[model samples]
Target chain A: MFEKLARMDRRIIYAVVFLSLSIPLIWPIGLGVTVGPETKELYNTVESLAPGSAVILSMDTSPGGYGELASGAAALLNHLSRQGIRVIGMGFFDTGPSLLETAFGGSDFKNKQYGTDYVNLGYLAGSETAIARMAKDIPGSFPRDYRGNLTPELPAMEGISSAQDVALVITISSGTPGVPEWIRQVGDPMGVPIATAIVAVNVPNMTPYMQSGQLSGMIPSMKGAAGYESLMGTSGLGIRGMDAQSISHLTILALVLLGNVVYLGTKSGASRGGGR
Target chain B: MRRELPVALAFAVGVLMIVSFFFTSEPLVEAAKTVQNWGVIIAAFALGLASVNLIQIHARRIIRGKGLDWLYSGALIFSMIGIALLGIVRGPTHRTYQFWFDALFVPGQATVYAMTGFFIASAAYRAFRVRNLDAAILLLSAAVLMLGNVPIGEKIWSQFPVIGDWLMNIPNLAGQRGMLIGAGIGGIASGLRVLLGIEKSYLGGSSS
Candidate 1:
């Protein structure tokens, strides 16, 4: 039985992972995540905004990571929308446009009218270069909307030229041409207050901007997303994923300890045997 | 000329973009906007072109029969051309195109996303071999996080939440912050090098 356990088929592992993930999702552990200082800072930055404050949201992740980030992004949008702030939603990547539509179009914020309450400038290409330009003259870079409507003609573009017109820029990015580019291009020079939410792998890259005050605040991956969601008094995918993430982290930690114990014990036994 | 001109052009564009970042003057900004708009159009075209390119390459490989599986290649090419023709010839609004996209594209992308399960499991298995003090800490932290995340563990043991929160907020944030600083510096340095023409990785392969 022990030998069989040692050489267990990968299907067993797959089943374990699937069951482990699905069970928590079905019956949430209701694990409370403490909203960290950074999350609070992010919340406050958006919260402090006066009504009619021009805000830009850059959704720069594909649909896959979108599922991971959807809750935080939706909650943030809801918070801003409640404030009656003017929103200009856009994406730096192609697939990002659809995800933003889903985030905003969801039940929580469905009544928000397109082009009046908010506008989607759609996916702009050329990666970081487009971001740099959009920071200056938005219409200059985005002459038209995704549907080919004249962008300058839209009410959302009223008095909005350059990053300065934006009171705050919240970019939820999964990777490159994201937070750092915003800091370098818009926040640093244009003085637009920048905030960002990014994947766990990217949190390290985003920290300096937050530290430097280039970014007003940040939501760091699913944990950060969960923390932000908790503060909003709404639990979503981010909060739910926490149990699975926590368990996975702990499982990895336990395996590491076991491996070390075996290694040390073997080493000691080998040393004593050599001495004999 | 073929390689060097494109590389040099990329270098020049990179500089212009960097300057456009700080300057924002009319000419610089206009040039930047023009370049960006052109890029958007080019990228849209590239997406379509890439699919066509993929079909051609696979079709050629199949014909040559040079260490390649012809039957599989044929199927792939047929799908590519099929989709392209459906969109271009029959129009994107046609039922055929919509059906192909919904049936093939949507599910394929979803399956790809779901495949991350295999990756995470492999990574976790490798990472969880506790060897020493740090390893023990990591192993323990991982277990706590997993238990806190999964329902059964929390159902059995209520204290999982507190420990999970601590693991994420303190150690996780610290590790993430360290990485962010390193990445920021790397990004800035890389962006500068590109602007200065010192890096030509974007110009494809070897600088020489």
Candidate 2:
């Protein structure tokens, strides 16, 4: 029995995980989610932004990260749109601008006027250096908006000459040229508050920044997205996906525990047989 | 002159950048900005170079007529050109371009990422065995963390979140900080080597 359990086919595990993740999506358990302090801080920071204040939304992730971060970005964008904050979108990664468009198009901001409530400055070529240049001169860094409009004349970009003018900077990041780059190049030097909606793998590394106050707030991952959705009184993908995440974690944990138990039992039995 | 000129340029630019950080003089700052701008231009060129290199390697594979390899190479080249042309001519915001990205590229990337969960589960089942005391502790901590991040964890035991947060805040933070500090020191050392022309690896040659 122990041998059979130990040698279970990997395909079975994959099927089990697929079912564990899928069933929850089809019929959610609707488990309660406790909002973490960091997520709350992020919510409060954006909430405190005065109406019409300009904020920099740097989409620094590719599609792989977008899968994990899209819900969080959507919830945050919804909150921002509701609060009447003007957003200036930009991307470090080449793929970021399109993802930003997709996120914005799906949000409550659909009715929001382009070039007035929000505008995409599109992708800049340089990574960290581009960020530094933008901090110094936003107009110089991006001469034209993603849609080919002159950035200097855009309504959303009015009076936003540099990073300092923005009320806050939020980086939805997956990798390098991301939160750390923003913090080093703009946030610290310009005295602007920085926040992030980062993928799950980055949560631990970024926690120290939150603790030290370099980051004003953070949405840790999809879980953070769900918490933000709950805060906003909306049911989005984040909330819908949490059931699967919960079940998947439990399944992995059970597999680990069962594997250990089998190993221990086999070892003990082998010892008794050797003694006989 | 090839090696000498490149080394001299790197040393001069590296020193100027470091000096500008400490001084507020306009000329030094301006020089630093110019160098940074040059860096950006070079990086852009490098990207073009990489694309050219990709095209060369794959085109060669097709020329060699290596069975399914040629097919894959053909597909890659076709996709690359198709996407680039679509973006350049019609713009990224065009309906057709957006549809390709949304329906095809995004799902392809998401599928690749989603597969990791299954792989991780399989790996955990096969590899997470208690062979020693340290292994037991590691397994226990992993279990705690896995459970704590999920809603079911708190449902099973409210303490899961509390313990998980404690583990992350205390031990995890300490370890991360140590790594950051160590990396910072190593970076400074590497920068110095490059600035002094002691590290010629960046110039496509060994230090020795």
**By TM-score, who's the top model here?**
2
The Cα RMSD across the true interface for model 2 is 1.2
Which stretches of model 2 miss by more than 4 angstroms?
A269-276
- For model 2 chain A, give the 10-residue run with minimal summed lDDT: A132-141
TM-scores of the candidates are: 0.77, 0.97
Native contacts retained, all candidates in order:
0.29, 0.66
Residues A196-265 of candidate 1 have per-residue lDDT tens digits of 8877666655654666677788887777778877887787777888877655554444444444454556
lDDT for residue A211 in candidate 2, whole number 0-100: 78
lDDT of 1 at B145: 68
What is candidate 1's CA lDDT for residue A89?
85
Model 1 bad stretches (over 4 Å) = A244-276, B1-25, B31-49, B61-111, B132-208
Interface RMSD of each: 4.8, 1.2
Q: Tell me candidate 1's interface RMSD.
A: 4.8
Shift in Å, residue B151, candidate 1: 12
Instruction: DockQ for candidate 1, please give it.
Output: 0.30
